[model samples]
Target: MTKVTDVVLNLIKIKGQKKEEAANTNERPPAKKQSPGELRLHKDIAELNLPKNTKVTFPNGKDDLMNIEVTLRPDEGYYVGGIFVFSFHVPHAYPHEPSKVRFITHPNIDLEGNVCLNILREDWKPVLNINTIIYGLNLLFIQPNHEDPLNHDAAVVLRDDPQKFQRDVQAAMLGGYVGQVYFPRCK
Candidate 1:
């Protein structure tokens, strides 16, 4: 009986050793590799020289390099003196793929926060940097394009009646009603 017990214990020990070895040998952990886009975003941030009244913050905190917030105060245009905030999400595929940007203002923002900027979407290329995007956003406010618009209504007004569109933009910036929605005073 004593010999049998010793044999049983040895068998158990051997089985446990086999299981441990199998786990160590068979498992391959997932690799962590930063994409080209992420590399570009990092480079862009490091090289950034922001303009006055233009601030950048990482809402997800510094530890998180993927998300960021950019606030703009245009010196000229209908959006002049207005504070507009934008959010940028850098996916793992970034630099190679354009960063996903969103406007996080009041609910008064168009249904899609669609910043109908050519540089941001159609004209985007690896050569473009954050500085370019910032400048483009400022341009959008200074000269809201009627021909190519994210907000159709705003575009229509801008195309059909430039004066009324300007008035509506001013009204919205001042925290008034352009239609049924009330915008917060950003100026």
Candidate 2:
């Protein structure tokens, strides 16, 4: 009986070791989570040079630094007196990947808030930071770039008839319908 008990214990130990090895082989140790971007972001935030009419807020609370809201109130140009809201989502990749940005839905902004601007798309470079983004958003209102516009109709109107484009912008900002599309008042 003693010999049988010893053999049983040895078999149990072998089975346990095999199970441990299987789990270890199947499960990889998680990669070390290093966030160099978070530190850089803190520095960028400290040195933020936003225009006078632009303001940034974190709706998810100050503790949640990953997401931010930028409100641009361009004092000049066609979009003057209108308030534009944009959201910035900083990804884990940081400076390596550009922060994702979206604006409140408007003629310029699709339903997904994907506002088309050079910096957010083709013009984006790792060197650009939050400050540059603010400037870009400001430029969107100060001067609507028709050549590479996201809103094709708006761009055509702006290119062909500047006055009519201004009227459409005004109407849209005043919560009216422009060509059957209803825009909420953002002025």
Candidate 3:
């Protein structure tokens, strides 16, 4: 009985010593598991083939993939020659939830950069990806939708006088004042 007790005590001491050695080692803790959203986002980004005159960038560097910046320079349309920059924040629940997009002020976008795109709102689905959103944003510049707008005043002008809307867009792009609002030059 005494020999058996000594053997049990020695085994316990060995187990404790192993645990202490493991804790003292410089080995890093296990890497954090990537969420479903992150995995999907990574896949989408890897497969991106951006549209003409459009480019996607990572303002926070490649390490931070959640935050993205897209630059669009339309080759034709009322927004032609104008440089528009949009910031996109992909949620951890991305694809399940649309990425939050903020863009420069436009007829389809508010002064505070709130975009009015259906896919980014009610029409979003898990099947949609970053490429789709970029394409949609590019389309907005090609055809500024006055029917569904976040900037109502701009929309009204676009709906009522297409020519004046064009002029106003040009003026706004040149850092001129459009009514009471002043837009910085982006051309």
> Clashes per prediction?
3, 0, 0
Whole-model Cα lDDT per candidate? Answer: 0.74, 0.81, 0.92
Give per-residue CA lDDT, model 2, range 1-187, as digits (tens).
9999999999999999998898799897645554777666777788999899999999999766778899988899888999888889988777777788886433456656787867777777778788998897787788777887667778889899999989988998889789877888999
Ten contiguous residues minimizing lDDT sum, candidate 3? 23-32
Off-target runs (Cα >4 Å) in candidate 2 are 1-34, 104-108
Model 1, range 1-187, lDDT digits (tens) per residue?
A: 9999999999999999998888789786544576676677788999988888689899988767788888999888667788998887877766656677776222223545656667767788878878777777767777777777667777787788888877887898888778876677887
TM-score of each: 0.74, 0.77, 0.84
Q: In the order shown, what is each candidate's alpha-carbon RMSD?
A: 9.7, 9.8, 5.0
Give the deviation of candidate 1 from the true structure as CA RMSD.
Answer: 9.7
Return whichever of 2 and 3 wins on lDDT: 3
TM-score of 1: 0.74
lDDT of 3: 0.92
